[model samples]
Target: MSERTPFRWHIAVFLAPAVVIYTLVMIIPLFATLDLSLYSATETGTKFVGLENFRTLFGDAHWAEQFWNAFWNNVWFFLINMAVQNPVGIALAALLSLPRLRFAALYRSAIFVPTILSFVIVGFVWKLILSPIWGIAPSMLAAIGLRHLFEPWLGQETTALTTVALISVWQFIGIPMMLIYAALLSIPEEVIEAAEVDGITGMAQFWKIKLPLILPSIGIISILTFVGNFNAFDLIYVAQGALAGPDFSTDILGTFMYRTFFGFQLQLGDPNMGATIASVMFFIILIGVCLYLFGIQRRLRRYQF
Candidate 1:
Protein backbone atom coordinates (compact mmCIF):
# COMPACT_ATOMS: atom_id res chain seq x y z
CA MET A 1 0.00 0.00 0.00
CA SER A 2 1.15 3.51 -0.80
CA GLU A 3 2.25 5.61 2.22
CA ARG A 4 -0.43 7.95 3.46
CA THR A 5 0.27 11.64 2.89
CA PRO A 6 0.74 13.93 5.91
CA PHE A 7 -2.42 16.02 5.66
CA ARG A 8 -1.70 18.30 8.64
CA TRP A 9 1.77 19.24 7.43
CA HIS A 10 0.48 20.00 3.93
CA ILE A 11 -2.14 22.37 5.32
CA ALA A 12 0.36 23.97 7.68
CA VAL A 13 2.88 24.50 4.87
CA PHE A 14 0.38 26.44 2.80
CA LEU A 15 -0.77 28.49 5.80
CA ALA A 16 2.75 29.10 7.13
CA PRO A 17 3.64 32.01 4.89
CA ALA A 18 0.37 33.84 5.47
CA VAL A 19 0.52 33.27 9.24
CA VAL A 20 4.13 34.44 9.38
CA ILE A 21 3.43 37.57 7.37
CA TYR A 22 0.40 38.44 9.44
CA THR A 23 2.33 38.02 12.67
CA LEU A 24 5.26 40.06 11.41
CA VAL A 25 3.08 42.97 10.28
CA MET A 26 -0.10 43.12 12.35
CA ILE A 27 0.28 40.97 15.46
CA ILE A 28 3.84 41.96 16.36
CA PRO A 29 3.22 45.69 16.15
CA LEU A 30 0.05 45.39 18.18
CA PHE A 31 1.79 43.61 21.03
CA ALA A 32 4.75 45.96 20.79
CA THR A 33 2.45 48.96 21.02
CA LEU A 34 0.76 47.45 24.06
CA ASP A 35 4.11 46.87 25.72
CA LEU A 36 5.31 50.38 24.94
CA SER A 37 2.23 51.89 26.55
CA LEU A 38 3.26 50.48 29.95
CA TYR A 39 6.57 52.34 30.06
CA SER A 40 7.35 56.05 30.50
CA ALA A 41 10.22 58.33 29.54
CA THR A 42 12.22 60.03 32.30
CA GLU A 43 15.34 62.24 32.47
CA THR A 44 17.25 59.21 33.73
CA GLY A 45 16.06 57.26 30.68
CA THR A 46 13.05 55.06 29.74
CA LYS A 47 11.59 53.40 32.88
CA PHE A 48 8.67 51.24 33.87
CA VAL A 49 5.71 53.32 35.04
CA GLY A 50 2.95 50.70 34.93
CA LEU A 51 -0.38 52.44 34.31
CA GLU A 52 0.94 55.97 34.84
CA ASN A 53 0.81 56.78 31.13
CA PHE A 54 -2.84 55.74 30.92
CA ARG A 55 -3.53 57.74 34.10
CA THR A 56 -1.95 60.79 32.49
CA LEU A 57 -4.06 60.24 29.40
CA PHE A 58 -7.37 60.03 31.26
CA GLY A 59 -6.78 61.65 34.67
CA ASP A 60 -4.59 64.67 33.99
CA ALA A 61 -6.80 67.63 33.07
CA HIS A 62 -4.38 68.94 30.46
CA TRP A 63 -4.31 65.67 28.49
CA ALA A 64 -7.83 64.56 29.36
CA GLU A 65 -9.43 67.61 27.73
CA GLN A 66 -7.72 67.03 24.38
CA PHE A 67 -8.49 63.32 24.64
CA TRP A 68 -12.19 63.86 25.23
CA ASN A 69 -12.45 66.49 22.50
CA ALA A 70 -10.99 64.10 19.96
CA PHE A 71 -13.11 61.27 21.30
CA TRP A 72 -16.38 63.19 20.86
CA ASN A 73 -15.29 64.49 17.48
CA ASN A 74 -14.64 60.92 16.40
CA VAL A 75 -18.08 59.93 17.66
CA TRP A 76 -19.67 62.69 15.61
CA PHE A 77 -17.71 61.69 12.55
CA PHE A 78 -18.97 58.10 12.90
CA LEU A 79 -22.61 59.18 13.39
CA ILE A 80 -22.64 61.27 10.23
CA ASN A 81 -21.44 58.36 8.11
CA MET A 82 -24.00 56.01 9.69
CA ALA A 83 -26.80 58.52 9.10
CA VAL A 84 -25.91 59.43 5.51
CA GLN A 85 -23.65 56.80 3.96
CA ASN A 86 -25.43 53.49 4.55
CA PRO A 87 -28.94 54.52 3.56
CA VAL A 88 -27.74 56.30 0.46
CA GLY A 89 -25.67 53.27 -0.42
CA ILE A 90 -28.64 50.96 0.01
CA ALA A 91 -30.82 53.16 -2.19
CA LEU A 92 -28.18 53.29 -4.90
CA ALA A 93 -27.65 49.56 -4.74
CA ALA A 94 -31.38 48.89 -5.00
CA LEU A 95 -31.74 51.17 -7.99
CA LEU A 96 -28.76 49.66 -9.70
CA SER A 97 -29.97 46.11 -9.06
CA LEU A 98 -33.24 46.63 -10.89
CA PRO A 99 -33.72 44.46 -13.94
CA ARG A 100 -33.75 46.09 -17.41
CA LEU A 101 -32.47 49.42 -16.07
CA ARG A 102 -30.82 51.35 -18.89
CA PHE A 103 -27.03 51.63 -18.71
CA ALA A 104 -26.96 49.77 -15.38
CA ALA A 105 -23.35 48.75 -15.87
CA LEU A 106 -22.38 52.30 -16.73
CA TYR A 107 -24.18 53.68 -13.71
CA ARG A 108 -22.51 51.20 -11.35
CA SER A 109 -19.07 52.04 -12.76
CA ALA A 110 -19.65 55.78 -12.52
CA ILE A 111 -20.99 55.61 -8.97
CA PHE A 112 -18.04 53.50 -7.84
CA VAL A 113 -15.36 55.63 -9.52
CA PRO A 114 -14.66 57.74 -6.47
CA THR A 115 -14.03 54.66 -4.29
CA ILE A 116 -11.06 53.58 -6.42
CA LEU A 117 -9.28 56.91 -6.31
CA SER A 118 -6.75 57.64 -3.58
CA PHE A 119 -7.97 59.59 -0.54
CA VAL A 120 -5.21 62.11 -1.26
CA ILE A 121 -6.77 63.11 -4.59
CA VAL A 122 -10.28 63.35 -3.19
CA GLY A 123 -9.12 65.38 -0.17
CA PHE A 124 -7.07 67.82 -2.22
CA VAL A 125 -9.82 68.32 -4.82
CA TRP A 126 -12.47 68.97 -2.20
CA LYS A 127 -10.10 71.25 -0.27
CA LEU A 128 -9.74 73.50 -3.32
CA ILE A 129 -13.40 73.28 -4.28
CA LEU A 130 -14.38 74.34 -0.79
CA SER A 131 -11.73 77.08 -0.56
CA PRO A 132 -13.48 80.47 -0.19
CA ILE A 133 -11.03 82.53 -2.21
CA TRP A 134 -10.44 80.62 -5.46
CA GLY A 135 -12.86 77.72 -5.18
CA ILE A 136 -15.66 76.83 -7.56
CA ALA A 137 -18.05 76.47 -4.62
CA PRO A 138 -18.82 80.19 -4.57
CA SER A 139 -19.11 80.34 -8.37
CA MET A 140 -21.30 77.24 -8.49
CA LEU A 141 -23.55 78.66 -5.81
CA ALA A 142 -23.67 81.93 -7.73
CA ALA A 143 -24.80 80.13 -10.90
CA ILE A 144 -27.57 78.51 -8.90
CA GLY A 145 -28.43 81.88 -7.25
CA LEU A 146 -27.49 80.54 -3.79
CA ARG A 147 -24.20 82.34 -3.27
CA HIS A 148 -25.23 83.46 0.19
CA LEU A 149 -25.11 79.84 1.35
CA PHE A 150 -21.50 79.20 0.40
CA GLU A 151 -19.00 79.20 3.25
CA PRO A 152 -15.40 78.15 3.80
CA TRP A 153 -16.57 74.92 5.38
CA LEU A 154 -13.13 73.43 5.88
CA GLY A 155 -11.84 76.53 7.64
CA GLN A 156 -14.65 77.09 10.15
CA GLU A 157 -14.49 75.47 13.59
CA THR A 158 -18.24 74.93 13.85
CA THR A 159 -18.58 73.17 10.50
CA ALA A 160 -15.12 71.72 9.85
CA LEU A 161 -15.61 68.24 11.35
CA THR A 162 -19.04 67.76 9.85
CA THR A 163 -17.84 68.99 6.49
CA VAL A 164 -14.95 66.51 6.48
CA ALA A 165 -17.27 63.70 7.58
CA LEU A 166 -19.57 64.43 4.63
CA ILE A 167 -16.59 64.48 2.30
CA SER A 168 -15.54 61.02 3.56
CA VAL A 169 -19.06 59.71 3.13
CA TRP A 170 -19.06 60.88 -0.47
CA GLN A 171 -15.82 59.08 -1.24
CA PHE A 172 -16.55 55.76 0.50
CA ILE A 173 -20.27 55.31 -0.14
CA GLY A 174 -19.43 53.08 -3.08
CA ILE A 175 -18.10 50.39 -0.72
CA PRO A 176 -21.42 49.74 1.00
CA MET A 177 -23.25 50.16 -2.30
CA MET A 178 -21.11 47.48 -3.91
CA LEU A 179 -21.36 45.11 -0.94
CA ILE A 180 -25.13 45.47 -0.85
CA TYR A 181 -25.37 45.16 -4.62
CA ALA A 182 -23.57 41.84 -4.48
CA ALA A 183 -25.81 40.69 -1.66
CA LEU A 184 -28.89 41.74 -3.65
CA LEU A 185 -27.61 39.95 -6.70
CA SER A 186 -27.06 36.77 -4.66
CA ILE A 187 -30.81 36.60 -3.96
CA PRO A 188 -32.53 33.93 -6.01
CA GLU A 189 -34.72 35.09 -8.91
CA GLU A 190 -37.35 32.41 -8.17
CA VAL A 191 -37.89 33.74 -4.63
CA ILE A 192 -38.56 37.24 -5.94
CA GLU A 193 -40.86 35.95 -8.67
CA ALA A 194 -42.82 33.93 -6.12
CA ALA A 195 -43.24 37.05 -3.99
CA GLU A 196 -44.45 38.91 -7.06
CA VAL A 197 -47.14 36.26 -7.63
CA ASP A 198 -48.30 36.76 -4.04
CA GLY A 199 -49.11 40.45 -4.77
CA ILE A 200 -45.79 41.73 -3.43
CA THR A 201 -44.72 44.10 -6.17
CA GLY A 202 -42.44 47.13 -6.50
CA MET A 203 -42.15 49.06 -3.24
CA ALA A 204 -43.88 46.38 -1.22
CA GLN A 205 -41.63 43.74 -2.70
CA PHE A 206 -38.52 45.77 -1.76
CA TRP A 207 -39.64 46.78 1.70
CA LYS A 208 -41.07 43.43 2.73
CA ILE A 209 -38.95 40.75 1.10
CA LYS A 210 -35.79 42.33 -0.26
CA LEU A 211 -34.94 44.52 2.69
CA PRO A 212 -35.31 41.76 5.28
CA LEU A 213 -33.14 39.39 3.31
CA ILE A 214 -30.35 41.97 3.07
CA LEU A 215 -30.19 42.89 6.75
CA PRO A 216 -27.06 40.84 7.34
CA SER A 217 -25.19 42.74 4.66
CA ILE A 218 -26.37 46.02 6.09
CA GLY A 219 -25.26 44.96 9.55
CA ILE A 220 -21.80 44.07 8.29
CA ILE A 221 -21.54 47.38 6.47
CA SER A 222 -22.62 49.27 9.58
CA ILE A 223 -19.87 47.68 11.64
CA LEU A 224 -17.33 48.37 8.90
CA THR A 225 -18.36 52.02 8.81
CA PHE A 226 -18.03 52.21 12.58
CA VAL A 227 -14.50 50.82 12.51
CA GLY A 228 -13.46 52.90 9.50
CA ASN A 229 -14.74 56.15 10.98
CA PHE A 230 -13.06 55.50 14.33
CA ASN A 231 -9.81 54.76 12.52
CA ALA A 232 -10.19 57.72 10.16
CA PHE A 233 -7.14 59.87 9.43
CA ASP A 234 -6.02 60.22 5.82
CA LEU A 235 -8.80 62.43 4.46
CA ILE A 236 -8.81 64.66 7.53
CA TYR A 237 -5.04 64.78 7.60
CA VAL A 238 -4.68 65.55 3.90
CA ALA A 239 -7.44 68.15 3.82
CA GLN A 240 -7.00 69.74 7.25
CA GLY A 241 -3.36 68.86 7.98
CA ALA A 242 -1.86 67.43 11.19
CA LEU A 243 -3.20 70.30 13.23
CA ALA A 244 -6.75 69.28 12.29
CA GLY A 245 -7.07 72.91 12.88
CA PRO A 246 -9.33 75.85 12.97
CA ASP A 247 -8.35 75.18 16.59
CA PHE A 248 -8.37 71.35 16.33
CA SER A 249 -12.12 71.16 15.90
CA THR A 250 -11.76 68.46 13.24
CA ASP A 251 -9.42 66.20 15.22
CA ILE A 252 -10.40 62.52 15.50
CA LEU A 253 -8.67 59.56 17.18
CA GLY A 254 -6.43 58.77 14.22
CA THR A 255 -5.18 62.33 13.92
CA PHE A 256 -4.87 62.52 17.68
CA MET A 257 -2.63 59.44 17.65
CA TYR A 258 -0.60 60.78 14.72
CA ARG A 259 -0.02 64.12 16.38
CA THR A 260 0.97 62.38 19.61
CA PHE A 261 3.36 59.90 18.02
CA PHE A 262 5.19 62.26 15.68
CA GLY A 263 4.42 65.59 17.34
CA PHE A 264 3.26 68.65 15.41
CA GLN A 265 4.51 72.24 15.75
CA LEU A 266 5.31 73.07 19.39
CA GLN A 267 4.39 69.63 20.73
CA LEU A 268 7.23 67.15 21.23
CA GLY A 269 6.86 63.51 20.19
CA ASP A 270 6.24 60.88 22.89
CA PRO A 271 5.95 57.27 21.78
CA ASN A 272 4.90 55.97 25.22
CA MET A 273 1.96 58.37 25.34
CA GLY A 274 1.19 57.70 21.71
CA ALA A 275 1.07 53.98 22.38
CA THR A 276 -1.37 54.49 25.26
CA ILE A 277 -3.69 56.37 22.94
CA ALA A 278 -3.26 53.66 20.33
CA SER A 279 -4.04 50.98 22.90
CA VAL A 280 -7.19 52.84 23.84
CA MET A 281 -8.18 52.99 20.17
CA PHE A 282 -7.43 49.29 19.83
CA PHE A 283 -9.71 48.50 22.77
CA ILE A 284 -12.44 50.72 21.37
CA ILE A 285 -12.33 48.87 18.07
CA LEU A 286 -12.19 45.52 19.86
CA ILE A 287 -15.25 46.32 21.95
CA GLY A 288 -17.19 47.53 18.95
CA VAL A 289 -16.33 44.38 17.04
CA CYS A 290 -17.26 42.15 19.96
CA LEU A 291 -20.59 43.90 20.33
CA TYR A 292 -21.37 43.30 16.68
CA LEU A 293 -20.24 39.69 16.70
CA PHE A 294 -21.93 38.66 19.91
CA GLY A 295 -24.73 41.13 20.48
CA ILE A 296 -26.11 42.32 17.14
CA GLN A 297 -25.02 39.67 14.68
CA ARG A 298 -26.43 36.92 16.85
CA ARG A 299 -29.89 38.43 16.62
CA LEU A 300 -29.86 38.74 12.80
CA ARG A 301 -31.40 35.58 11.45
CA ARG A 302 -29.82 34.56 8.16
CA TYR A 303 -32.40 33.33 5.66
CA GLN A 304 -31.28 30.72 3.18
CA PHE A 305 -31.80 32.43 -0.16
Candidate 2:
Protein backbone atom coordinates (compact mmCIF):
# COMPACT_ATOMS: atom_id res chain seq x y z
CA MET A 1 0.00 0.00 0.00
CA SER A 2 1.20 3.48 -0.88
CA GLU A 3 1.28 6.11 1.85
CA ARG A 4 -0.53 9.39 1.31
CA THR A 5 1.73 12.40 0.74
CA PRO A 6 2.01 14.77 3.69
CA PHE A 7 1.68 17.70 1.29
CA ARG A 8 0.19 17.67 -2.17
CA TRP A 9 1.84 19.70 -4.93
CA HIS A 10 -1.13 19.26 -7.27
CA ILE A 11 -3.55 20.72 -4.72
CA ALA A 12 -1.28 23.72 -4.08
CA VAL A 13 -0.80 24.21 -7.81
CA PHE A 14 -4.53 24.14 -8.49
CA LEU A 15 -5.31 26.52 -5.57
CA ALA A 16 -2.57 29.02 -6.43
CA PRO A 17 -4.34 30.73 -9.32
CA ALA A 18 -7.63 31.23 -7.44
CA VAL A 19 -5.79 32.42 -4.31
CA VAL A 20 -3.72 34.90 -6.34
CA ILE A 21 -6.81 36.19 -8.19
CA TYR A 22 -8.81 36.61 -5.00
CA THR A 23 -5.95 38.45 -3.32
CA LEU A 24 -5.73 40.85 -6.24
CA VAL A 25 -9.44 41.30 -6.82
CA MET A 26 -11.10 41.10 -3.39
CA ILE A 27 -8.72 41.08 -0.46
CA ILE A 28 -6.33 43.77 -1.67
CA PRO A 29 -9.09 46.15 -2.75
CA LEU A 30 -10.99 45.64 0.51
CA PHE A 31 -7.93 46.48 2.60
CA ALA A 32 -7.13 49.40 0.33
CA THR A 33 -10.61 50.84 0.83
CA LEU A 34 -10.27 50.45 4.57
CA ASP A 35 -6.93 52.20 4.43
CA LEU A 36 -8.36 55.02 2.36
CA SER A 37 -11.02 55.69 5.00
CA LEU A 38 -8.34 56.67 7.55
CA TYR A 39 -7.09 59.61 5.47
CA SER A 40 -8.61 62.89 4.28
CA ALA A 41 -7.95 65.20 1.37
CA THR A 42 -6.36 68.53 2.19
CA GLU A 43 -6.04 71.79 0.21
CA THR A 44 -2.51 70.94 -0.82
CA GLY A 45 -2.57 67.16 -0.49
CA THR A 46 -3.93 64.40 1.79
CA LYS A 47 -3.34 63.62 5.46
CA PHE A 48 -4.30 60.85 7.87
CA VAL A 49 -7.39 61.71 9.95
CA GLY A 50 -7.72 58.45 11.90
CA LEU A 51 -11.34 57.84 13.05
CA GLU A 52 -12.44 61.44 12.44
CA ASN A 53 -14.21 60.49 9.25
CA PHE A 54 -16.13 57.72 10.98
CA ARG A 55 -17.16 60.11 13.74
CA THR A 56 -18.41 62.59 11.14
CA LEU A 57 -20.33 59.86 9.35
CA PHE A 58 -22.05 58.63 12.51
CA GLY A 59 -22.30 61.87 14.47
CA ASP A 60 -22.11 64.97 12.26
CA ALA A 61 -25.51 66.61 11.86
CA HIS A 62 -25.77 66.55 8.06
CA TRP A 63 -23.86 63.30 7.40
CA ALA A 64 -25.69 61.43 10.16
CA GLU A 65 -29.13 62.23 8.75
CA GLN A 66 -28.26 61.03 5.25
CA PHE A 67 -26.48 57.97 6.61
CA TRP A 68 -29.45 57.06 8.76
CA ASN A 69 -31.81 57.55 5.84
CA ALA A 70 -29.75 55.27 3.64
CA PHE A 71 -29.43 52.67 6.39
CA TRP A 72 -33.18 52.59 7.06
CA ASN A 73 -33.88 52.47 3.35
CA ASN A 74 -31.54 49.49 3.03
CA VAL A 75 -33.35 47.76 5.87
CA TRP A 76 -36.64 48.38 4.12
CA PHE A 77 -35.20 46.97 0.91
CA PHE A 78 -34.09 43.76 2.63
CA LEU A 79 -37.42 43.40 4.42
CA ILE A 80 -39.40 43.76 1.22
CA ASN A 81 -37.41 40.95 -0.41
CA MET A 82 -37.96 38.73 2.61
CA ALA A 83 -41.68 39.43 2.72
CA VAL A 84 -42.48 38.98 -0.95
CA GLN A 85 -39.55 37.44 -2.83
CA ASN A 86 -38.68 34.50 -0.59
CA PRO A 87 -42.26 33.29 -0.10
CA VAL A 88 -43.06 33.64 -3.77
CA GLY A 89 -39.90 31.71 -4.66
CA ILE A 90 -40.79 28.96 -2.18
CA ALA A 91 -44.31 28.68 -3.61
CA LEU A 92 -43.03 28.61 -7.19
CA ALA A 93 -40.48 25.94 -6.25
CA ALA A 94 -43.16 23.79 -4.67
CA LEU A 95 -45.39 24.09 -7.73
CA LEU A 96 -42.52 23.21 -10.04
CA SER A 97 -41.52 20.18 -7.98
CA LEU A 98 -44.98 18.56 -8.03
CA PRO A 99 -45.15 15.07 -9.49
CA ARG A 100 -46.57 14.50 -13.03
CA LEU A 101 -46.72 18.24 -13.73
CA ARG A 102 -46.92 18.88 -17.45
CA PHE A 103 -44.37 21.16 -19.13
CA ALA A 104 -42.48 21.37 -15.86
CA ALA A 105 -39.12 21.82 -17.56
CA LEU A 106 -40.45 24.52 -19.83
CA TYR A 107 -42.08 26.29 -16.94
CA ARG A 108 -38.93 26.13 -14.82
CA SER A 109 -36.80 27.40 -17.69
CA ALA A 110 -39.17 30.28 -18.42
CA ILE A 111 -39.36 31.19 -14.75
CA PHE A 112 -35.57 31.26 -14.49
CA VAL A 113 -35.02 33.25 -17.68
CA PRO A 114 -35.11 36.63 -15.95
CA THR A 115 -32.54 35.59 -13.38
CA ILE A 116 -29.70 35.25 -15.87
CA LEU A 117 -30.26 38.63 -17.53
CA SER A 118 -27.98 41.53 -16.66
CA PHE A 119 -29.33 43.97 -14.07
CA VAL A 120 -28.76 46.82 -16.56
CA ILE A 121 -31.06 45.15 -19.08
CA VAL A 122 -33.69 44.49 -16.45
CA GLY A 123 -33.48 48.08 -15.25
CA PHE A 124 -33.88 49.59 -18.73
CA VAL A 125 -36.62 47.14 -19.75
CA TRP A 126 -38.68 47.74 -16.60
CA LYS A 127 -38.05 51.48 -16.72
CA LEU A 128 -39.32 51.68 -20.28
CA ILE A 129 -42.27 49.37 -19.59
CA LEU A 130 -43.29 51.51 -16.63
CA SER A 131 -42.78 54.87 -18.35
CA PRO A 132 -46.00 56.85 -18.50
CA ILE A 133 -45.56 58.55 -21.88
CA TRP A 134 -43.64 56.29 -24.24
CA GLY A 135 -44.42 53.03 -22.39
CA ILE A 136 -47.33 50.61 -22.01
CA ALA A 137 -47.99 50.81 -18.24
CA PRO A 138 -50.51 53.66 -18.36
CA SER A 139 -52.29 52.18 -21.36
CA MET A 140 -52.44 48.75 -19.72
CA LEU A 141 -53.97 50.29 -16.61
CA ALA A 142 -56.48 52.18 -18.82
CA ALA A 143 -57.41 48.96 -20.57
CA ILE A 144 -58.13 47.37 -17.17
CA GLY A 145 -60.21 50.44 -16.19
CA LEU A 146 -57.71 51.17 -13.44
CA ARG A 147 -56.06 54.16 -15.08
CA HIS A 148 -56.48 56.09 -11.82
CA LEU A 149 -53.77 53.78 -10.46
CA PHE A 150 -51.62 54.34 -13.53
CA GLU A 151 -49.67 57.35 -12.27
CA PRO A 152 -45.90 57.10 -12.81
CA TRP A 153 -44.91 54.85 -9.91
CA LEU A 154 -41.19 55.47 -10.33
CA GLY A 155 -41.66 59.22 -10.35
CA GLN A 156 -43.50 59.31 -7.04
CA GLU A 157 -41.58 59.34 -3.73
CA THR A 158 -44.26 57.36 -1.91
CA THR A 159 -44.27 54.49 -4.40
CA ALA A 160 -40.75 54.62 -5.89
CA LEU A 161 -38.94 52.48 -3.32
CA THR A 162 -41.69 49.90 -3.15
CA THR A 163 -41.91 49.75 -6.92
CA VAL A 164 -38.14 49.30 -7.18
CA ALA A 165 -38.22 46.63 -4.48
CA LEU A 166 -40.94 44.70 -6.31
CA ILE A 167 -39.03 45.00 -9.58
CA SER A 168 -35.91 43.64 -7.85
CA VAL A 169 -37.95 40.84 -6.34
CA TRP A 170 -39.35 39.88 -9.72
CA GLN A 171 -35.89 39.81 -11.27
CA PHE A 172 -34.12 37.73 -8.61
CA ILE A 173 -36.86 35.52 -7.14
CA GLY A 174 -35.83 32.84 -9.61
CA ILE A 175 -32.59 32.29 -7.68
CA PRO A 176 -34.41 31.25 -4.54
CA MET A 177 -36.92 29.33 -6.65
CA MET A 178 -34.22 27.22 -8.27
CA LEU A 179 -32.39 26.73 -4.98
CA ILE A 180 -35.54 25.63 -3.12
CA TYR A 181 -36.55 23.44 -6.05
CA ALA A 182 -33.21 21.65 -5.88
CA ALA A 183 -33.59 21.22 -2.14
CA LEU A 184 -37.12 19.85 -2.56
CA LEU A 185 -35.94 17.45 -5.24
CA SER A 186 -33.24 16.09 -2.93
CA ILE A 187 -35.89 14.46 -0.71
CA PRO A 188 -36.02 10.72 -1.05
CA GLU A 189 -39.03 9.27 -2.90
CA GLU A 190 -39.32 6.60 -0.20
CA VAL A 191 -39.76 9.21 2.53
CA ILE A 192 -42.43 11.00 0.50
CA GLU A 193 -44.17 7.65 -0.17
CA ALA A 194 -44.14 6.88 3.55
CA ALA A 195 -45.64 10.29 4.30
CA GLU A 196 -48.33 9.71 1.67
CA VAL A 197 -49.20 6.28 3.13
CA ASP A 198 -49.60 7.88 6.55
CA GLY A 199 -52.24 10.29 5.13
CA ILE A 200 -49.92 13.29 5.32
CA THR A 201 -50.71 14.70 1.90
CA GLY A 202 -51.03 18.15 0.30
CA MET A 203 -50.25 21.11 2.56
CA ALA A 204 -49.74 18.97 5.62
CA GLN A 205 -47.02 16.99 3.85
CA PHE A 206 -45.33 20.20 2.74
CA TRP A 207 -45.51 21.88 6.13
CA LYS A 208 -44.82 18.86 8.33
CA ILE A 209 -42.42 16.74 6.32
CA LYS A 210 -40.91 18.78 3.48
CA LEU A 211 -40.56 22.10 5.27
CA PRO A 212 -38.62 20.66 8.17
CA LEU A 213 -36.12 18.95 5.88
CA ILE A 214 -35.59 22.11 3.85
CA LEU A 215 -35.07 24.42 6.80
CA PRO A 216 -31.33 24.56 6.12
CA SER A 217 -31.92 25.53 2.53
CA ILE A 218 -34.50 28.15 3.52
CA GLY A 219 -32.11 29.55 6.08
CA ILE A 220 -29.40 29.76 3.45
CA ILE A 221 -31.77 31.50 1.08
CA SER A 222 -32.78 33.98 3.75
CA ILE A 223 -29.19 34.90 4.57
CA LEU A 224 -28.25 35.06 0.89
CA THR A 225 -31.23 37.29 0.20
CA PHE A 226 -30.31 39.50 3.12
CA VAL A 227 -26.71 39.89 2.01
CA GLY A 228 -27.58 40.37 -1.66
CA ASN A 229 -30.22 43.00 -0.96
CA PHE A 230 -27.96 44.92 1.38
CA ASN A 231 -25.16 45.03 -1.21
CA ALA A 232 -27.33 45.56 -4.30
CA PHE A 233 -26.65 48.66 -6.46
CA ASP A 234 -26.66 48.02 -10.19
CA LEU A 235 -30.39 47.73 -10.83
CA ILE A 236 -31.20 50.68 -8.56
CA TYR A 237 -28.47 52.78 -10.10
CA VAL A 238 -29.61 51.97 -13.61
CA ALA A 239 -33.29 52.46 -12.91
CA GLN A 240 -33.20 55.53 -10.67
CA GLY A 241 -29.74 56.92 -11.49
CA ALA A 242 -27.08 57.56 -8.83
CA LEU A 243 -29.21 60.15 -7.03
CA ALA A 244 -31.91 57.54 -6.37
CA GLY A 245 -34.13 60.54 -6.27
CA PRO A 246 -37.76 61.52 -6.09
CA ASP A 247 -36.35 63.48 -3.14
CA PHE A 248 -33.73 60.78 -2.37
CA SER A 249 -36.57 58.58 -1.17
CA THR A 250 -35.10 55.44 -2.72
CA ASP A 251 -31.50 56.12 -1.69
CA ILE A 252 -29.77 53.15 -0.05
CA LEU A 253 -26.21 52.63 1.14
CA GLY A 254 -24.84 51.55 -2.26
CA THR A 255 -26.18 54.58 -4.09
CA PHE A 256 -25.26 56.77 -1.16
CA MET A 257 -21.70 55.49 -1.31
CA TYR A 258 -21.52 55.88 -5.07
CA ARG A 259 -22.82 59.42 -4.94
CA THR A 260 -20.27 60.26 -2.28
CA PHE A 261 -17.41 58.71 -4.23
CA PHE A 262 -18.18 59.91 -7.70
CA GLY A 263 -19.99 63.23 -7.08
CA PHE A 264 -23.59 63.87 -8.13
CA GLN A 265 -24.96 66.92 -9.91
CA LEU A 266 -24.18 69.51 -7.21
CA GLN A 267 -22.10 67.58 -4.68
CA LEU A 268 -18.36 67.22 -5.06
CA GLY A 269 -16.96 63.66 -4.77
CA ASP A 270 -15.40 62.78 -1.42
CA PRO A 271 -13.31 59.63 -1.57
CA ASN A 272 -12.62 59.53 2.18
CA MET A 273 -16.31 59.67 3.03
CA GLY A 274 -17.10 57.14 0.36
CA ALA A 275 -14.48 54.75 1.69
CA THR A 276 -15.89 55.19 5.19
CA ILE A 277 -19.35 54.29 3.92
CA ALA A 278 -18.00 51.26 2.07
CA SER A 279 -16.21 50.13 5.23
CA VAL A 280 -19.42 50.53 7.19
CA MET A 281 -21.28 48.51 4.59
CA PHE A 282 -18.60 45.83 4.82
CA PHE A 283 -19.09 45.66 8.58
CA ILE A 284 -22.85 45.43 8.18
CA ILE A 285 -22.56 42.55 5.75
CA LEU A 286 -20.01 40.86 8.01
CA ILE A 287 -22.30 41.13 11.04
CA GLY A 288 -25.19 39.65 9.07
CA VAL A 289 -23.06 36.75 7.83
CA CYS A 290 -21.73 36.13 11.34
CA LEU A 291 -25.26 36.09 12.74
CA TYR A 292 -26.34 33.58 10.13
CA LEU A 293 -23.36 31.34 10.83
CA PHE A 294 -23.59 31.40 14.62
CA GLY A 295 -27.21 32.23 15.42
CA ILE A 296 -29.26 30.91 12.49
CA GLN A 297 -27.37 28.10 10.74
CA ARG A 298 -26.53 26.24 13.96
CA ARG A 299 -30.21 26.02 14.88
CA LEU A 300 -31.34 24.78 11.45
CA ARG A 301 -31.23 20.98 11.52
CA ARG A 302 -30.70 19.04 8.29
CA TYR A 303 -32.47 15.72 7.89
CA GLN A 304 -30.47 12.75 6.69
CA PHE A 305 -33.11 11.71 4.17
- Top candidate, metric lDDT: 1
List TM-scores for all candidates, in order: 0.95, 0.94
Off by over 4 Å in 1: 1-10
Each model's lDDT: 0.94, 0.92
Which stretches of model 2 miss by more than 4 angstroms?
Answer: 1-11, 302-305
Total backbone collisions for each predicted model: 0, 0
For candidate 1, what is the lDDT? 0.94
User: Candidate 2 residues 138-215, lDDT tens each?
Assistant: 888889888888878899999999899999999999999999999999999999999999999999999999988988
Candidate 1 pairs with clashing backbones:
none
Error of 2 at 17 (Å): 2.2
lDDT of 1 at 204: 90
Question: Distance from true position, residue 180, model 1, in Å?
Answer: 0.6
